[model samples]
Target: MRTESVELTVLCLIHKNGRYLLQDRIKNDWKGYTLPGGHIEPGESIVDAVIKVVVKRKKIIYRGE
Candidate 1:
């Protein structure tokens, strides 16, 4: 059997004031309230993905590591 290992998606825990960002994954194998995430581009660092995908998508200015 052919097999391959790769980094695909990233989940982020973003909290503001008193709320945790989440999503309703209403498709595929995901069904319910789940953390926000998306596909990680090839050669992209996890930190960059978090900032570019999750943070940018939400439009929330994140200023901490």
Candidate 2:
């Protein structure tokens, strides 16, 4: 029997004034406008993963820093 591994990922939807935020991906394999998100790192919580992905992808400044 063969086994398949599952990977965990997260996606976030930011809505403001009836508008939603999306990312315009230019990579060859993933070229298109899509939601901003990424895979969760090992031992990382879902909330932390969401924050990290959003900040890294969108270049959002951390107000708590």
Candidate 3:
């Protein structure tokens, strides 16, 4: 059988100052405060996924790095 491509997503939520990041998708399938991450290449680890999402979404530098 031919292999089918798949996409994966993850959310790394960060709560600070008594608030959290939220996203409202157009699909309306889901709505809420969520640290969203997704569509990372295969062989990538969870930590990398989180960092990629946080940096892209928040535009904040990773101090720990």
Output the number of the lDDT-best candidate: 2
Look at candidate 2 and give me any clashing residue pairs.
none
After TM-score superposition, what is the CA distance of residue 21 in candidate 2 from its true location, in Å? 0.5
What is the alpha-carbon lDDT of model 1 when measured against the actual structure? 0.84
Task: Give one digit per residue, the lDDT tens place, for model 1 in 1-65.
Answer: 99998778988887879989888788888789988888789998988988887768868777675
**Candidates ranked by TM-score, best first?**
2, 1, 3
Clashing pairs in 1: none
Better of 2 and 3 by TM-score: 2
Cα lDDT computed for each candidate against the true fold: 0.84, 0.87, 0.70
Q: Which scores greater on lDDT, model 1 or model 2? A: 2
Counting only residues 3 or more apart in sequence or on different chains, how many pairs clash (N, Cα, C under 3 Å) in candidate 3?
A: 0
Query: Each prediction's Cα RMSD?
Result: 2.6, 2.7, 3.4
Candidate 3: misplaced stretches above 4 Å?
A: 1-6, 26-34
How much is the lDDT of residue 3 in candidate 1?
100
Clashes of each: 0, 0, 0
Model 1 has a clash total of 0
lDDT by residue (tens digit), candidate 3, 1-65 = 89997887777676779977665555566655455666676998878878777786658677772
Give residue 58's lDDT in candidate 3 (0 to 100).
57
TM-score of each: 0.69, 0.81, 0.60
